[model samples]
Target chain A: MTEHGEQREVFLGRVRAALGHTQTIVPDEPPAVDEALVRLATHDDDLITMFCDRAASVGMHVDRITADELVDQIVAKLVELDAKWIVVGFDSLDQADALNNAIEAADIQIVNWLAGGATMDVQFDTDVGVTDVHAALAETGSLICNVDAKHSRGLSLIPPVHIAIVGARQILPDMLDYFATQHDATGIALPSSQAIISGPSKTADIEGQLVTGVHGPGKVFVYVVEDV
Target chain B: MSASTTSLTLKGHDILFPPLPYDMHARADLATGDDQLQRFINNATLSKDLQRREVCAQTFGDNYDAMRSLAAEIKQHTLDHLDHYLEQFVDAATGTGAHVHFAATAQQANEICVGIAKREKLTQCVKSKSMVTEEMRLVPALVKVGVEVVETDLGEFIIQIDDDAPSHIVAPMIHKDRTAVARAFERELGSPYTENPQELTQIARNHLREKYRTADLGICGANFLVARTGSAVICTNEGNGRLCTSVPRVQVAIVGIEKLVPDMNHLAVLLKLLARSSLGQPITVYNHIMTGPKRKHELDGPEQMHIILVDNGRTEILREETREMLRCIRCGACLNACPVYRKLGGHAYGAVYSGPIGALITPMFKGLDKYPDLPHASSLCGACYEACPVKINIPKYLIQLRAQMVRRRITKWPDRLFYGLWGMSLRHPATYRFGGWVQKQMFRAKARAAGTAGRGDRYTDRGWLSKAPGPLAGWTRARDLPTPPSNSFRYWWKMRS
Candidate 1:
């Protein structure tokens, strides 16, 4: 065995010794799903308003609209911002047909951020990037995105401006509610990389002065469609 | 060798405990001299503390304490069953194509990382702000082996360039003003001097952006490791966490074993408190839950992922008395709330971790003999406990550390003698009165001598000792020692009754 492997056994042995456990002790079972849902239900009311208010407070531009109007709103916002090039995740294209059509109709150059699609340079050069949020937290105004083969991480990160389309029904009350929904008795399946983005990139590192657009997107727009 | 070995050398790798470059008093003096830096630390920490209060109240409302209790309980439970959770995490992380390594010491951890870099033939290693990496002192190790490691966080980058240690955990360069940063940048980066924070941040962004593009390795520290999902959750405000994780071909996260949450449910509880307590943000700009390397069909992300679970001295701290220190999420709320830390700054602690938590842990991790002064640094104020998101009773631990110090006879002779005598006298009322009478007489003699020597203060016509003789001189050096009353408090009480 390698030194690290030996160290691993020894470390685990020491941990067991410290805790007075000689053998592997299985953890207690997680709470039931219905119990978790009951706890989640307590914070179910006023989620959209809370999410919008919290999102706006953290420098994210939030707009609520019907699902039918999401494409027009996104296209209009892109035009308003004068974005010439946009990159989008494959998941967004697979999920939102109207959004895809609207991007084509708006005459904006769109790059697909998949493995055989857009390169890192193309994503870096894009003016706007859009992705559909898997879930959102109302209390923190966070948008959750899970990165996989179809949903490239850079689609939402590299652009100067990012437009996240969060379905109103997908918004959870808080991180607890989000986690409760993710848990299962056997195991929780997670993506390679899951991001909980609260707002635009910012830093107070330089003399404690807050500055945005350090490396990631400077402007983040969240379009909350009431219907999915 | 037993795992409880205290030797500085571990597994053919030399664990270093370099002597503090400067004494605490010197750093305190420097902090005092720089009014701007002092004001900056004070304002920044105070503002963060205020914001943390407001946001936590606004978000959790009456459930704030309940959330903290749940977080603490989860941490304690996970720690108790750490072996199971760690094995589970390793299995799940490996199941997702991540290679897991274990390091029993800082040297071993550095060696593991250096070994990876060598195997990959990595040239540039980009890193986000990770206090564990700072504690491991990994950059110098990597640099020693001809691998150029660049700190991508703006504050860490500035301090790294300046060859200075981080003064604050969250804000590494909190002690540095704009002028200092501009000077450092001009001297090091050969950039034109500019004091504007936005411009400075832009310069760093432009510089690091190029490094990110070409860097072959990305290193980070995990804020929390979810056992159920096998993810390393990294939270950051500057988005460096995302860039570091995504841009590099090889990514490594060096996490302390105590950073585990039982599941994502526990992680949710911690996430709520972590940001609010650290920066008063509802949440950081990016909270990336990285499970492993890039998938086979992913466009970008590390092709190889490695998670090094480092023990160093953490396993020692997992003992019953000091286990609470492991609950720290490195949010640095305790540091911001500590009065001693606020006045002296982080460098004064002379450890990678500073502030109240630092004081408590340093003694345990580095041995009470080596860092005996840390336990005495605090005034036993419970502000750190109140501010701690996990609600680690820091003052309680500090008092425990002091008791351990006393029991071990590690305290200085004079201090031990003084406290011992005081304790004995307090046990007996007659002896206490007699000791007070003797103290009063001694003070009267000093006052008479000062008056006769024409050293009386004009304002109150009283003799105040400017400098005291003997062991008490340590107290009187910076302040006057007022004369004690001739009549003892007990005597006065008896007469009145």
Candidate 2:
């Protein structure tokens, strides 16, 4: 309920008076923006190279590998992280059964997200978060984390380490494409929360010293699995 | 509003930082005398300014200026028709299962937020970084209502523990160093003191994560509120923004109406410039776009989302003449590029905002008469204008504010009389020439008397005065005044011809 029922009307009235409008007016069209002026990267650029280079520059470790290496790489990476437990966002990957089997054989515990009422508290105890990105951007090397029934918002955050599996086909050239893609995919109905991740959570606040993983993942590793 | 109330602490809880001292001289004296402030703040702002320039130039190359112009145009267009876009936004957001509220003043905004807490029976609150929330003095207000609110941003967390005010818009702790963080943590959080920034950051990270996990309600400020989608886009590098909005049961975003952008494409342009201008990053680490509360099928997110569109004093600024000032994206580029802000630091401005943009708007927000010194704070160097991503002509607006001050008699009569006489002198050739002749003779006489004349430069024998007398003394306080050349330009031109 509104604290004051008429406050909205009163506030809008004042705004209308200030704008000298008898009625609220939306302009016929917004100011025209030149695409050429606003866009930094074009479709002609090699998106894979751009995404890899830009992601690495921002401190995220980016690797390009064939899909054949996907399961082995995932297992090797988990061993390298020394993971006691991992929070998985999606239920399926390329080889879901084989992947779980590999992880179990490697002695890594996968937290059952559905087994608990306090999903977040359980996720907080994990060493890493692993998920497949909705899309990646070449322009800024950002990963688009779209939240839905199949995916959890905290999977890409909360944990100290985030490992994202991005497919080459899912990479977009610019942020403009991400927005455009959303309009086409859902037709104005967006996910509950859409986050664009460019790099690990970092801060330069304490005397301008750069520190990563302050409140989010400190290390972000992106594996761009090649699409066959 | 009383300038002398150092104990602006509300409800016996220190929610607000002590206001900047009313006396400009005292404020400047404190900044100029502090060696730590001189070393850290000066180096940070100067280097950030250079980084901003290099990155923007490197990325945009030739279209940078035009892009800035486009950004300015979009913001201006939005403000011109804010009423319509705001209405559209309210309806669209409401359709997304979000509650929209309106607040006409800062007090009203706080009351509405407190009202939400009472109705929902919420106690623990976590907040991300927001200048608007700072303007509302939200933390202390919530504390007064018995709601424990924790500032989640690393710098803001330290600031809350230390009972200090933020000193920068983006990097709020720019005025402090690792030593201050170490001391604050050791005393307040019971952590062992460590002057290393990396260690200090780790301590804060551990502490803030617990708050993020437990907080029942979250508060945030929006960088841009998209009217078309009924969405609020929050840009943060630390990822706390995601946790604060995601982990809480209820999420409340308090935003000034001026944050509205017409569409998503417009948001893209601003986002491209926001990080580059502020921190030299191509983009912030987390650009979170939230449409509404968790849907029936969504796995995780806040169950309820409330957006309070706070007018505060933005409507007053919307009066066409000052409307362009609202185009500021709050990138802090102006602060980084400002000579005065770099020299004095942010706290000297005596407001939540500081630097060139602050100099223009702070007076307007808190009466020119109350903060009369702010209008004249700059040297009118125009670096701020050059650096503004949205192209706010800060120097031009500052001059207008000074003119307004003179017209309204906010300036002292003596200073007004001096400028007025100086303006009058420039009208006539005879008086102008006469005034110039007198100034030259006096400067030369003073230099000669001080034994600093003509021995200054071997090549030209031009004299310099280490100090000047009377009203001119302030100019020479920090620097020596070069003696006026022997002959007037008019005389020399006449003689040459």
The best candidate by DockQ is 2
User: What are the per-model DockQ values?
Assistant: 0.54, 0.73
Candidate 1 DockQ category? Answer: medium
TM-score of each: 0.92, 0.94
lDDT of each: 0.80, 0.85
| Ten residues in sequence with the least summed lDDT for candidate 2 chain A | A112-121
Off by over 4 Å in 1: A1-5, A27-44, A90-107, A185-188, B1-23, B452-463
Top candidate, metric TM-score: 2
Measured by lDDT, the strongest candidate is 2
* Displacement of the residue A51 alpha carbon in candidate 2, Å: 1.2
Count of clashes, each model = 0, 0
Error of 1 at B356 (Å): 0.4
Candidate 1 lDDT by residue in tens digits, B262-347 = 77867777776788899988678899999889887776789999999988888888877677789999999998888888777876
Question: What are the chain A TM-scores for all the models, listed individually?
Answer: 0.84, 0.93
- Candidate 1 backbone clash number: 0
lDDT of 1 by residue, A1-228 (tens): 123434567879888877778987987863222233213334647888889988998999999988777778888998998988888863653347667778888888787655455766567778999888889988678899887667888877888899998888889876777776766535545678989998999999887789998988889999888776
